[model samples]
Target chain A: MGVNIKNLSILIAAVALAGAWVGQGQADNEVVFPMPTGPLYVKECGSCHTAYAPGLLPARSWQKMMNELDNHFGEDASLDEPDRLAILRMLTDHAADNPNANMLMRRVAASIPRGAAPQRITETQLFRFQHDEVPAHIWKRAKIGSKANCGACHTRANEGRYPEREVRIPR
Target chain B: MMRLLALLFVMTTPAWATTPQQILDSLVQEARQTQSGFTASVSRGEQFYRAKQTGGKEADSCASCHTDNPKAEGRHIKTHKAIEALAPSANKQRFTDPAQVEKWFRRNCREVLGRVCTPQEKADFTAYVLSVK
Candidate 1:
């Protein structure tokens, strides 16, 4: 009975050690902003432009964008009713204003005024502050057509990771 | 067991999988139903493709983003996103899916012409793209 007890204790210790190791690994690999996953969101929205992280905007902004899809940025991007609602749910659930949003996303949400619902992420104060160093002429480059083309400079924008080290302005 | 396996295989296969020719034929049929003697015209399609539209933000045409040559790769006029060639000869996946074909047609026609395209226009446009070698 003593031998069985000792073996059980050893197994418990091993399991505890394994759990700690896994927790440490997760902490080490945690990204600043994890990518949202939705096949319809990528297939429909990503087809035209970068499928921006929903954490970039508040829930109100996403609502407005989804409602005005017919005249989206001077282009017709209207989706079927089901697709529109599904994407809206996905966007609002992960928006910066969402309770489960990360620290940075909360900061982004706090930066905007209470009443204002900015349509473009490029128009946001945080965006301007982040891109203050970039010259105006850089945005006009043929390779980087406009501010909306995040993937032009951010190599892994599609993957939803935008580390400063990954940026490569095209000539 | 063999019959069960065959049933499972058939269930797993997509019923919507179709060829570009099949989609084009259906669009042509719809056009004929709308107009008694409707026939797809490649030259008319080319003219429609190249015409400069006035209603939208800019004087953008189908050629604005798709370019004059359907076989060559094009870029999104604003976003600069690289678009695949429209011609079936250059890109085998051009008109394979009915849903994708309809979605793009609905969006692009409205963006360029300020309205959805008729079945006749869709048929002629498909014929023009399919004709390109």
Candidate 2:
């Protein structure tokens, strides 16, 4: 009986060791998406404006942005083929549908319901609410209120992303 | 010097010091307490975007006709083009009232997750969608 108890303890220790190894291995394989804007994000658009964040949309939105580059908001933000392909790959992979993604992303894709008419789009709801907090003087600025100007205040914009700190409204 | 130190201490405090996960949990619990047909299951945001109606009657989810790939053939209800990826400013008309946001949560949650969304789930979900560029 004494020998059997000792063996059992040894086996338990081995199992725990195996579990730790497996857990560590799993953590390493985890795929984190919409990695912070890379050099291209900064190099390309950052010259004129701040880069937009990748987590801004699921793959679909990125695809749309890529396709419309030829006529991007009256501006030609098109990329060199290699850069375009790379950015698209990154954005789509990090899209909002990914359930295993970070907590901030999961919430965005989950569902926030936009009401009937007057507001059928989700972004509108955000701006409507977000704008409420901003002073009207900011919106009426020399080149503001385009809505795409979200990066105006969300500074990380030019680097292909937006961060809260970049939001310095023109007085 | 003491006043400056006191000001520094106040500034250093975290605004909410809350993890996004905790916020999501709270929203999920809120959905449970409300019982307004909203679901509380938080799915992977990217999966949800590409998520086709797995067990639904028709292939007509925000993903389906919109196409599994949004860039190629997006046909979300309004956008005539291949679906424009979802964005807040892409369309402000998505929501008018706070309650309406809840309504869609209930309906879409059932459509997507096959259930209702909890408040924290919705909040988390909202954060993800809004985060998109």
Candidate 3:
């Protein structure tokens, strides 16, 4: 019976160790943000531009963006009240400032000043800092028209994974 | 026999599924209710699609994003996103849903004309796109 208990303890220790290792692996892969679900969010927002990962902005920024959909940037992206609210919930639930946000998303939220809600993710300090090395003319490339086009270089932008090795700048 | 009939109905008409012709016909019907003797014109739709408007942004028109050729794939002027061809011949999924049809008309018309498109304008635009090969 004592030998069986010892073996059981060893098995439990191995499982705990494996769990910790997996948790560490997840933390290291912080580039992957949570992708928003629902057909409405994808179709309505993605039709015009990239449906950016919700973790790219804070909850407040998303709230501001949702509120001003009638004059979104320079275009009208108005949605029905229910749809707008649904998309808003999806965005805020996974926004950078969300309590359950991952490390990378936490950094995104931390970079922005308190009470400052920026509509454009490209205009964020972290985004600019990350792409600081990229020349101004690179954004004007025919294949990479604007900074808003994250998938132009980050091929896995759609999957919410922006790994450095996966980036491929178009000529 | 009833089960067979139900299956046949489902196979022929999926829920919320629509065709370009059906969508255009419905738009025409709506326009007629608003304006008696209303008739959708392919030529008028072509003109509307090609005409530059001054109400919204400078040089904005349906052609600005959809391109002059509805059969050709277009790119978003600002985001550079690839918009599939608008013509039914080139893209089978152009006007398949009534809701999707209304959504784009509401958005593009406001962007280019700075106002919601009238039922007549929507019908004309559909007629013009359907005429494209």
Model 2 TM-score is 0.37
For model 3, residues B1-133, the per-residue Cα lDDT tens digits are 9999998997988644788889999999999999999999999999999998988763389899889999998888888877789999998878887877888888788888888899999999899999988
- TM-scores of the models, in the given order? 0.83, 0.37, 0.88
Residues A58-78 of candidate 2 have per-residue lDDT tens digits of: 555667778876444433345
lDDT tens per residue, model 1, B1-133: 9999999987887745778889899999999998978988998888888888877555378889889999998878888876779998998877887888999998888888877899999999888888888
Off by over 4 Å in 2: A1-37, A111-124, A143-145, A155-168, B1-133
RMSD, candidate 3, Å: 4.4
Better of 1 and 2 by lDDT: 1
DockQ, candidate 1, comes to 0.63
Better of 2 and 3 by DockQ: 3
Each prediction's number of clashing residue pairs: 0, 69, 0
Q: Candidate 3 docking category?
A: medium
In the range A36-152, model 3's lDDT, one tens digit per residue, is 875777787787788789999999999989999988888888899989999999999989999999889999999999979998898999999999999989989998898888888
DockQ of each: 0.63, 0.01, 0.68
Whole-model lDDT values for every prediction = 0.85, 0.50, 0.88
With a 3 Å backbone cut-off (N, CA, C), the pairs that clash in candidate 3 are: none
Error of 2 at A156 (Å): 4.6
- Share of native interface contacts recovered by each model: 0.70, 0.00, 0.67
Tens digit of per-residue lDDT, candidate 2, span B1-133: 9999999986986544544345445565676676665544325544555555554333335565445433342442221212334444354433333433554455456555555554555664665554444
